[model samples]
Target: MVTRVTNQGPLTGVRVIELAGIGPGPFASMMLADLGADVVRVDRPGGGGFGAFPGDLLNRNRRSIAVDLKQPEGRDLVLDLVAGADALVEGFRPGVTERLGLGPDDCLAANPKLVYGRMTGWGQDGPLAQRAGHDIDYLALTGALHGVGRAGERPVPPMNLLGDYGGGGMMLALGVVAALYAVRGGAPGQVVDAAIVDGVSVLATQIHALRGIGLWQDPRGVNLLDGGAPFYDTYECADGRYVAVGALEPQFYAELVRLTGFPPDGGDGPQDAGAAAGGEALDRDDPANWPALRAAWARLFRTRTR
Candidate 1:
């Protein structure tokens, strides 16, 4: 399995230091370790009192070191580790690392080639830089939450995957790798400011392109890819379960019609009583026709367990 294999290929000799936190930090470290980087997670004394199950895959492929940064001996030990390391990742809000005397400046002073990566919700400098926020807040600030859900419905959260993992953690890892490559030749000591808000905006690149075209609309549930296309959305199966429909293209639509045994010329289309009352075709684009189409599709699926 892709999840089980380690040391298979690539990133075999890379060294990375991860300052433990939550969400993005652990995810980023997991990716790095999966790709064969030797990642050492620096945890606080007594494991920071976080509740986590044993055998957590995120903490796998990594070694843990307990350190008390408040003490001079512990601080020296971390600096010593930095002296021979390639990169370091931290996910504290703005100035927390600097306050602990383990900031980029201090780490870079010890090892000039260190690629210091900082991950946070809001960035290193801004009005809300120091404020505590989570993934939903980050997505909200970046205009990502606005275009998320159905029309007239409340914005649905896409979990932490979008803001934390996609934007913050992945960006930090990429920045670290790029900086490491740059410093291998020259240009030592780089800092990567990876914020969840910034990363989410960067991820909106394709969405912006869709908006530039006439196909995308500002209103939610009216766009092609955002649950607006009736043919591309989920439908209720007869068992009260759900199945997705994706007859986007003509060929797929023909296949769907053939599979469902709908008439080729669109004749006798959807014999549902609701559609018969409306005198409409079972076309997905027509909202008034969806109820009928849904009923017909439900009847078809009811014969099968799925």
Candidate 2:
């Protein structure tokens, strides 16, 4: 009989078996736990992951069991858990799980209805599938790394946020839910190859679409959203602090102009924002005027405090 865990969440009573790993895998399981799934993490005996952080929020909302996969008995323990679980998550690179005798086939055999989630930098089968890589390597290969940062400067990693959490972990969690949803419609269990490369690529959909329509450029910066426009970028204040502005729409930009003491146009204002900043007048829709606007905003911004 399946025990019902009441009052937790919409996912209450759902059981997930997570094979402990780092980064994306644990984060995915944490999302599962957050949604009220009864997630049981299988940590290696006396070999729990990344001992540096004790109060890891990722490990919360889930219980753990230690087992030695090197031992046949330990293998049996995980298989037994699989038989009673709704889904299983793992982040072993390529064939590591297969070598451990705990691949998708083994787990699926244990539970015919199981949704097996495999998280990796590359996918299950690709040119780079077997290549060892981390979040940076994956993001670099996916064109995402080339799309960030200030113009003419090196592209900055958004830390591991894009690859590990948003792209990999959150994508895996979404895939799990989607696979589980399919099972409700009489679909059989299947492997969810949640690759960080693939996930980050998906995150670039809008940019890709914009590029196709001649709106986005291939350079690191110099785009509407990626720190190209003055009104949409960060400014350093007088206190050595910074402030961000995102007046994307015309109305918002107008509001910003009205408030920041910048003129709405090169019109009859007492202080011409473009002239005072030693640049030509700026027209919002004219790409040629963007740099002038950026300079004007910068000059004004430097005069303010945080």
Candidate 3:
């Protein structure tokens, strides 16, 4: 068994053993360690599939120990460590830990008050739980990717932010904290099944609300919050740099219009918005005129330095 070290924070007294993996799992452990938990990462003999970089910021604020789980002694050593730990976080396939004899059952048996946190792409017991996936796959499956990008273009991948960190890691950290809190309140430690797919779906709660209210359309990049709105999207400046505009409110849009010196009410001169709608003026409120207004804004913004 490895020696324990005390840390300082809200979770100062908490102990966490992380079975080191990649991406979201490490990210979650980093958060726990940052919050004052004594997070000890268990790496394989060589490495944890990924090479170690001295500048790996994701694994900061944590200690690491290499253990050969294939060895009976090594497995026993981990179980011994689990006996004293407050939590164990693992991000493996559905049955990888079970096959290694360190599943939740094994850890919980060692410490009933232990919080067993599981991170995965799908979930613990879903149809695709055993399937291989990544952040992009989870985002695609959860309908999060479809809503991104321009109207006629393919969906733009938001890197791993949406699925790996935002959905998976953050959610896992939250669940672990909540579970640890429950243990402090005299509740038995439980497993936290944090799946990227599940979390991504939850992150789309507002999108779901928009859809239900009939304000959001099914197509991508055409909604008010999407790039469809002239005032809510980014524009290329004169210097070829892009500036993001999020003036969604009418007052903000009016201010934006005033500041840009683009003709007020979309005409050569200031005029009533209703009067300019029928003319060549770019009507900001009309969805049909979005392309035209966007063209106008693009032209206007291109004349200004970013």
Candidate 4:
């Protein structure tokens, strides 16, 4: 048995075993560690994670030890750690851990109250569960990538933010926390299968609802929140830097217009700051006037510094 020191936070007494991988799994463990869980990262011998970078922020707030899991000694060491842990996080294709004798069943047998959080690109039992994929691939399959970028341009990758961290890591962390809560309430600990594809789909719930209500279109960058609206996108400044615009509400848009000295209409018309952005001659509600408004905003923003 090894003694561990935990920091002061919401999860002060909780212990987590993070089987080192990359991206989402590391991020999930990072969140737990941030909340003051004593996260023990089990790395393979010779060190691991992001080219063994010492400053990998995702591996922060935790202790780490290298163990060669291919050998019985290493596997036994991990099982010993699992026996005392409240949760375990691992990100790999399905069956990888099972083959390594570190699967949920193995760890759960060692500690039945363990929250076995599994992070993957697909899922545990899906058709592509064992397939290789990255954040972009998961987003693409979940219709998230399709909605990004301009209407006429190819889908632009939103980096790994959506699938890897937001959808994947956040969901896994939430699931672990929820499972821990249940365990405290006398419920049995269980597996949390947080697949990036499923998580990204859940993240797009608003878009699905909008599509169901006919308020959203199927094409990219043609919706109210998908950069189709002139007031909801970014514009370039004179310094070649870009600024994001999210003045969705009328008052906010009016404030934006006031601050930027922008004319609502393309011409030098009366600045109806009190007009609702959803209606009136503000032209914000009309899709036909979007091109002109976008052009005018573009021209105006180009005159600003940043």
Give me the candidate number with maximum TM-score: 4
TM-score of 4: 0.92
TM-score on alpha carbons, each prediction: 0.86, 0.90, 0.90, 0.92
| lDDT top scorer | 4
User: After superposition, which runs of candidate 1 have C-alpha atoms over 4 Å from their true positions?
Assistant: 1-8, 49-53, 263-304
Better of 1 and 3 by TM-score: 3
- Candidate 2 lDDT by residue in tens digits, 72-150: 9998889999999999999988888888889999999998899999899888887888887788888888889998798
lDDT of 4 by residue, 1-306 (tens): 224455789999999999999999999999999999999998877774453587778878888888998998999999999999999999978998999999999999999999999999889886888788888899988889999899999999998899999999999999999999999999987899998988899999999999999999999988899999998999999999999999999788877876666775565444445442323455678888898889888988887788
Candidate 3 wrongly placed segments (more than 4 Å): 1-7, 48-52, 267-283
Cα lDDT of model 1 by residue, 141-230, tens digit: 898988889877988999778998999889887887788888887996899888888899999988988889865788887666777765
> The CA-based lDDT of model 1 is what?
0.77
lDDT of 3 at 245: 92
**lDDT of each candidate versus the true structure:** 0.77, 0.83, 0.86, 0.87
What is the model-wide C-alpha lDDT for candidate 4? 0.87
